[model samples]
Target: MKRNIKRIIFVVAAVAVWVGAFFMTQRLLEPKYMDDLIEGALTAEYYDETTKHDVIFIGDCEVYENFSPVTLWENYGITSYIRGNAQQLIWQSYYLLEDTLRYEKPEFVVFNVLSMKYGEPQSEEYNRLTLDGMELSPVKIKAVEASMTEDEELITYIFPILRYHSRWNQLKSEDFEYFFKKDKISHNGFIMRADVRPATTFPEPEPLADYTLPATCWEYLDKMAALCKENDIELILIKAPSLYPVWYDQWDEQIVEYAQKNGLAYINLLDKCDEIGIDFYSPETADTYDRGLHLNLSGAEKLSNYFGGWLCSNYQITDHRNDPDISAVYSEKSADYYAMKEDQLRELSEFGELKSY
Candidate 1:
């Protein structure tokens, strides 16, 4: 009996060591996203929020790069968060919403409509950028299944070490520096760019044979609408004022019809660029970082200010600035936001580009 007990303890010890080693290797192999491709770090940062948000924005780069949550809080005291990733698909957006519901529910969910143009998974790199930051859950499993390309494997995601094992020799200082903890890369899901690249020119958009958005996109969108309704959360659809990868009139019409038929509100910001004070033409006052592709700090703040007012007018979103608990949190966030802006501007002035942001 004593021999049997000793054998059992030995087995348990061996299993624990193996499990620890496996996870440690996984952590070591995964890209830190500290220096390069910092966008990959945005998704996981949401899990660290101490205070609840009144509004949640989920979509792609359009939502993340175009709106500033800090501006929303400062102008209207509207607490909000953006759960966006680069090229995040419609199905991925739906699944992200599902995952977010596990946390606090917001009064409103704002979705950018640009991702509807993609009917299928776009690329493996984009898939990793979005999914790697998500916590392991059923929603993540579904998202991975829905977003994987033909060459991707499920096991690679499950054990990222499998995919990144080759990175052993290519490892940088950040890989070890941020092994246990990662530095925050975004300001409440807003990627700040203080530099302005004026809209000089754009390639002509090619005419598509079919202007209709895919049924798969519509199906996921339907699910998003239903989920929001069930949770008593109002869903607002908006087309951000991006001047490239063109927002054709045909696509806009379909979104308009969907919003009208479902009694939802949809705003095409392109139509209101003049009213919103967005200047894409002037280099001195341009608010874009990549020639009208994504909004810079100036543009994001303007858009956030206008949208915050519209949200206050339309919904019951409260001004939480006076709440001591939430106020303390946001006050610190505001400081960090300004500090980052200062750093980016300094880098731009000295180097003619941003190096650290």
Candidate 2:
């Protein structure tokens, strides 16, 4: 009996050490989005949210960079979160919504329609930025299967170390600093930029040979709509007021027709830019940092304020600002939001750009 016990203990100890070393290696090799490429960190940050969100926005950078949840909370008492990624494909957005539902179902789901233009996976780098941060689940598996490019491998996502193990020599300070955990880099999913660079000129949009959004894109959208309906959640589609990658008339017509067919509300904010008080062309009042591609902190707040009013008027979203528990959560979030904004401004004033983000 003693001999048998000793053998079993030795095997267990060996397995434990091997398992620990494998995970440690995985952690050390994986790219830490802490210093730069921070957008990769956004998806994982949602899991750390303490209070439940009433509205969830999912799409590409347009949804994340153009809208501010903290502004919505302060102005209209609406609590929200954005589950956005860089160049998020429609299927990925749908899967992300599904993944979000696994955690908490919100009263409303807002999707940006810019991704409708993409029918297939764009790039493996973007796929990793969006998927690697997601917690392992059936939804993530499906997202990976749908998002992987021709050259990409599925096992690489499951075991990122397989893809990044060679990064041993390139590993930086952050690789170890954030080895155990990551810092919250966004303000309720909003990446703040206080610097301003006004829109000057944009390259003429070369007309696409085909105006019709792909069948695959529409199919995933149908799935998104059906899932929202089954969960009794309202879905709102919007074309954010981005000046480039022009929103063609033919494309807008198709979305309008679809919205009518499904009894959904699709607001083209590009049409309401003037009404929303956005001065994209003026340097003194410009809201975008990279010309008109994405909004700065000032622009996002303006957009959120207008959109929040429209939402409250059209829907019965409960304002949790007065709710003691939720209020406490927002209070802490608001403090962080302003502090970051101040820091970004200080950085911009002194250094001509932000360094901490």
Candidate 3:
């Protein structure tokens, strides 16, 4: 009986060694798997690295909807990238920031204030999504090095188990691909051109209730603030525009108070949607696509143009769209797009229906 037990142990050890060898060897052999899983996974063509002082936008779909790196590159001359995710939480934001600061550090981080307005999830989503979609880069180690408690930050950042205690399933070979590819650019933003839906306004996703944020969400938000301060990176907290009914119902004076207390730079475009110029009540709209949550090509163009102006006016960025090569691409792509977007802007300029939150 003892001999049998010893035999079982030896067999288990040997199998573990063999499995490790296969993964390690395969990783070295087919590093493309790493590239495939992680590469160009988000924005068009994925993971395109930019130069110094380039803007880095981080958040959920809002970031995607609000800014176009390609447009930023073409319009502002300051290259940028979107590190947005779908349904990402505040905890995930911290990790994403912690992980993102690894590679090329940006001049500033535009953190979407929406998560601060988020209702905390009861499940492990906050931590799980952070760990799962988490990509560790050159910034991860530096983040730890700069962390107040280096040891703990290093442990949690390295393993994620310390931070996301519920992350039990170890990363298999498959995850390695995702980790590496998260850096890629996503091409499919606001790609759809035509819109076909009458726009009224959306009801509150819930009732007309004030949002009471969870403490953990606040903890992550504070960590992000501190992390930015520690790294000497500027944090621009934006309160982006959405429809009025939902916007008023979701965010209130309490949210306003929190932003003020944090010394966050708030850009509340809620009522300024008209000043920014968007035909929200237009007969044709993006509501047909993704119901109404995301923006279409027409919207994205307006956003890029608006944000492009904002970046130029406020941020220390230059407009280089005149550069022959970029403009050639933009000019080529902007043909019909320019027409559609201009019409939207013109219509919005004419139709004044923006209600303040």
Candidate 4:
């Protein structure tokens, strides 16, 4: 009996030590988006939302960089969140929508159509930005299965340490600082950039033999629409005003047809740029950070103001800025948002460029 008791105690102690070590190693290995790779942190930050939003936007950098949820709240009393990442694919957007339905059901879901151009997974790095932040669930599992490129392994996602263990040499102060806790990198999923660079000359888009969207892209679009319908949620489709990546007319036709068939509202903001008061040709008016690919803070605010008015006139979304609880939370967010803008401006003034993102 004494020997058996000692053996049992030994096993228990061994298991406890192993568990602790496993978690510690995992923490150290995981990427901390505190300093760089901030886009990787945007998707996961939605889980920290204390108040529910009336609108949820999902897509790639187009939505996150172009839209400001905080602006929506302040200007139109509309509450919103953007579930966006770098190069988010169509299937990933669908799974994210599914994952979001697991939480509070928003009145409207805005999906950018740029992702529909991609049929298969694009890159492992982009997949990490959009998927790594998602909490484990059936939705996340499906997203991983759908988004993994040929070079990716599902087991690496489940045990990220397996994928990142080799990053030991690359570990920095941020890894230790945000090992257990991560700082908020977005204001309601909106990643703000307060710098400006005018639209510049770029290589013209190569003509494609086939402008048709992939069948797989259509499949996920149908699934997303059906999911929204089943949940009694309205899904609005829009083409964000990106000057490049060339919004082909053929692609626009398909989206228009899909919207008509499904009875969904589709807005091609590219065509409405003039009406939205966006002057893409003039950097002095509508500024962009990386040439014309993504909007800067000024452009985002302009777009958001226009979108807010359109949303109010079209939908029955409630303005939560008046509710004491919601107002209190957003007031704090507003302070942070302005403080960040000031900080970025100061950096730009001092360095002639943004040193930190």
Candidate 3 residues lying further than 4 Å off, grouped into runs, are 1-40, 43-53, 122-133, 136-185, 188-201, 208-210, 249-252, 285-288, 318-357
Off by over 4 Å in 4: 283-285
Q: In what order do the candidates fall by TM-score, top score first? A: 2, 1, 4, 3
Error of 2 at 90 (Å): 0.7
lDDT of 2 by residue, 214-267 (tens): 999999999999999999999999999888778898999999999999989999
Task: Note the Cα lDDT for every prediction shown.
Answer: 0.93, 0.92, 0.54, 0.90
Clashing pairs in 4: none
TM-score of 1: 0.98
Select the stronger candidate by lDDT from 1 and 3.
1
Q: Select the stronger candidate by lDDT from 2 and 4.
A: 2
**Which 10 successive residues of model 3 have the least lDDT summed?**
31-40
TM-score of each: 0.98, 0.99, 0.61, 0.97
Candidate 4 overall Cα lDDT vs. reference?
0.90
**Candidate 4 lDDT for residue 94:** 92
Candidate 3 lDDT, 7-88, residue by residue in tens: 9999999999997865454333322222332321342222333333356777766666655555655556655656665545
